[model samples]
Target: MSSGIMKRRPLKAADDKVHDFLTTGIGRVKALIRGSVKGFAKEHRPRSKNGRTAKAIFAEAQSPTDEDGNEIMIQVKKLSKIYGRRPEEALALLREGKDKGEVQSMTSNNVGLYDVSFDIRKGEMFVLMGLSGSGKSTLERCMNRLIEPTSGQVFIDGLDFTSLNDEDLRIARREKMSMVFQNFGLLPHRNVKDNVAYGLEIQGIPESERLERAVASIELVGLAGYGDRMPSDLSGGMKQRVGLARALATDPDILFMDEAFSALDPLIRGDMQDELIRIQSELGKTVIFVTHDLDEALKLGDRIALMKDGRIVQIGTAEEILQNPADEYVDRFVKEVDRSKILTANLFMRKPKNILYETQGPRTALRMMDNCDRDDMLVIDGEKRLIGMARSDGILRAMNAGDRDISGIVSDVPSVRPDTPMSEVVQIMVTTDFPIPVADDDGILLGMISPSAAAETLRNGGGE
Candidate 1:
């Protein structure tokens, strides 16, 4: 009798599996695990606190997730103020002048804000957003009392801000808050280290202590070796990092970033944003961010306060802002957002039931694949050993194979381990032609899927 011939793949070594998983199939496991183990070997799993797992710490440290959650951190109550002179008629002013009783208001005609009220949670990044001349920056300044409000009260950390005298306010600034400006505000004459340490030096820290603190701050911003460089020698992003280090070096109660990254190029801006996120994750500082860019607001805000004409229009998170826009203005702001990157697979992924993948027939597998929005189908034999995958291309190829052989085409094989990310799955699809067989580490088929299905799911309300 003829020996039963079986097509067998060369067994790969342990390291090869790691290399393949990392390089060709990264997205398949990008969800929980970053890349494959071989690749992530160098990647220091982000250190967590109190010996907690990254998952638990992640849940704790993700960020100001939404408006309602953010409200608990920072609170503003019926905050109101105005600027720019209301049209003062000459006749009315003349009558007032005759009285000399009209206390001449020295306030400017430009109103920065009016009756703004909101609360931001601890570990939240609150963003103040507005367009040009909308008074968002003015509100930011007022929040930290950078530009003193003409009228109305401000409170930070329940300190009754408007009530603080100059001496008290100055002390609060030194002890409780740090600010970053759009212009960076670096000292041209000072080197990066000296400029960053300037705040500590101003606070009368000893020279040795200040220098040590400044070096630590620089490393925190990823400018580890650039301490001696001057402001003129640094790039825009590096300069911003210096500003970040300066703000952080103070170890204040809150960080105020006022258009801190608006000056950089898009790529550099993204880098800075990522850096800020990493810093925020590590430090967990309360941040009050000011920006005009809606994208930036969406990118960073735990709760975004949208301002118009010196008044708050809406305050919510990226999801809330995208899903429940307050008005046409807010709607227009995010009309063209690509939501896939924002929403994750947690919104989708349902278990397939009544999935039929008989070894001989393609119809069962195809139907199941369609309903699950999966790119491929799982194949099984009598014992359900996940024998193979039933795929569109394989079925077509079987048809083209004509008379002699069709059974060998759709054999179940090469299943990926569970906990693979969609990105990894897509990368595999790009590199390989055959329908990818997904399996547990023991090589049991759990069914098959493809990159296209993942994209479709994301497009469809995150498979809501």
Candidate 2:
């Protein structure tokens, strides 16, 4: 027989037998798998080649530096999910250069995702965004295996998530990641504290410890005293906070939020979005958020992947997508975005014409400020971290006061990071007389956003 005929004949012959077995004996197979997992666990838990447990591997991956110098926390390679009995045939059609619609038309398989590939870096808020049926939610579910993909691989912390068995996958889900859904999945019977502690309870954590963590998480979500109340007693926004608290209580390495704020009122939705941003900034957790709202995606995503027809149409920062869209569709998608809200301070900030060191004397500081034709100068310390701002009047006074250095006269100035949106930058600019210093997280001076620069950028509708 020919090779293709030989393969097809056996598959056809076994199809009936396999169907009969599945119809009657699938429960036994599940039991056997569970028993095997238990026996294996009793013998020895699975470990990586480096001898680290799953928890250890995921924990170490949270560090900024990786041993192999790879900073990616999650890598999805050519992931596709098809819904149909003949998914294999559909996949073959897909690989043969058929689009999702064409493949569905040919094989009657709905393509949920198509050759989707992306990487999420550690401590980054990565958003998958598109309209309904664009495969954004399907992609998120595939990453976590809530909806198993028809083909391709997902790697979390260098471990192949798709290849993991049931026991290992359960452990990874409990220890490495958590998800928040659109519907607040809080148990109506359970009080707020118990709802938040549900995951830890599943892990068989001691009650006291889990409750303590739950309480802390409640406080983190700003629902401090509501832990004793039932979910039904809270408002829509408060209930969502409980859901967020439940996910955060586990302190998972990755947080997957699928339309997390979509169910709330518009005002509450905005508030929740802000809360998420504040929490993400404080925790620095890797977040994979899914949303259909462009404004929410732009506000929350450090980088966004825009999907269309089961494939990603573009991947970039909000400013990048707005300024340089990949195709006509992407351009049309972002054509109506408010540029001021999307543009960041770094886009328009200029290098400081004159900077003063803390060790510099008043006379030297004043001279530099005069030469630059400026009334203020940013002062930095020995390590080039921002100290404060020194005004020309302060320097002049310091000169007469016989001060040794300009450090004593330096006054605290409001500062912002380069990634701060220009809308916020303009707000800060109006409140302060001096230009706002743009500093990095380490407080190192990067540049300055002057009033004129901010106004000009805003006037030109977010400059090039």
Candidate 3:
């Protein structure tokens, strides 16, 4: 299997079956029981000596699964939305490759979305980001069927949400989806507790049960004592919390947030972002968040779908977008981003070519340096734990000194964890002549990040 990271592929039927089995508790239990029975029947099972499971091997081979192993919570295919009296005609013009503005001008209709398609995976904070009129919010609205899409299909867990009738769609909205909007959509007359309980109330939940759920949700959003206060009394951030609590009170599987944090002050917005992360970590709900601020999108999104002029231009993780922009628009979007804070050692590091084990003699080390045409080599123990650095001169000196092993000539080298951000990595790189080593918590040598790689990554961010 190649060591390089793999791009995600569309799910196959077999992959979907495996995903369903793994995601469902009953299916997982059945599989575990079956494995145990087979093990008992054979009295033993063969284990890989390297300690990797079959699934892990397949994943390393980049077979049909995403690296995060998240299930698809929502899937949108060829989604396009047009506005105006005759949207169907406008959609036909769009399908003919007419420019959005041209189609709208020629048909006297407005384009709200332009063939936007993507997936929101389970437990992932997927972000929709774009300037106003870019169709980010429109796309988000279409996901929950708040705005009917003129053309395209929306599948929620393999069920076509766009195909559902109004009654069934209403039921699905109540039981499966919850939305938080940019404006704190709170009822002005109602107190915070009542506002939070409104969704449950709409669902016809009993008063006591609804209030209990609402209170728990209010507390979850850090508005425990502020529940009794009216929206008028609470600050903007607090009111937004009420909105969050209201949406969460229903405990729906999918969350749709359209600019939910854009109204708050910067400090409060940062706090809310962190709070959302904490809550999402605990709850593991599938979240589709909409934002216009690039910083906010980078900070909050697990994967961002950047929209431009009613079309999705790019979709990727922050690092992926920074390191490999899809086009000039994407290039401009990431131009001002601080690569040091977003790029990690894992992304910047390259595989080590020549390694010297501690058990090898100085002569062996020198020979490798000549063959690999390198001045220095990383020294590791038998278990691949990086211990030190060995220079060609040092190896020769050790050999001349009659040392049996190169361990005597080994020197301490700078190292970092795989996830260490490039912000700190640059400081370490400038002080060391050697390529920085990337290791895990256990000190196992994983890869090397040369100074040139760091420079290249920064340059890719449109920096020096």
User: Model 2 over residues 111-156: C-alpha lDDT tens digits?
Assistant: 9998989888888899999889999999999999999999999988
Candidate 1 lDDT trough over 10 residues, lowest sum: 98-107
Encode model 3's per-residue lDDT on 254-359: one tens digit a residue: 8999899999999999999999999999999999999988889988899999998789999999888878999998887676454534778898888987899998
Count: clashes, candidate 1: 36
Candidate number that wins on lDDT, 1 or 3: 3
Tens-place lDDT per residue, model 1, 1-464, is 22322222233455578887787676465634733453545423222223332233223322323445343434566554444455233224423532112312432333455557776677778898888777778777887787766555665654466777665566667656789989999999999999999878766666567789999999999999999888999989999999999999988768988988888898999999999999999999999898877788888987898887667878888789889989987776675343334433332234433434455544444455668776555556565556555566766666566523224665545555455555555556667664455566665555556555666755665432
The TM-score measured for candidate 2 stands at 0.61
Q: How far is candidate 1 from the true structure (C-alpha RMSD, Å)?
A: 23.4
Q: For candidate 3, list the clashing residue pairs, or say none.
A: none
Best by lDDT: 2
Better of 1 and 3 by TM-score: 3
User: What is the TM-score ranking, best to worst?
Assistant: 2, 3, 1
Candidate 2 runs further than 4 Å off: 1-53, 56-70, 336-464
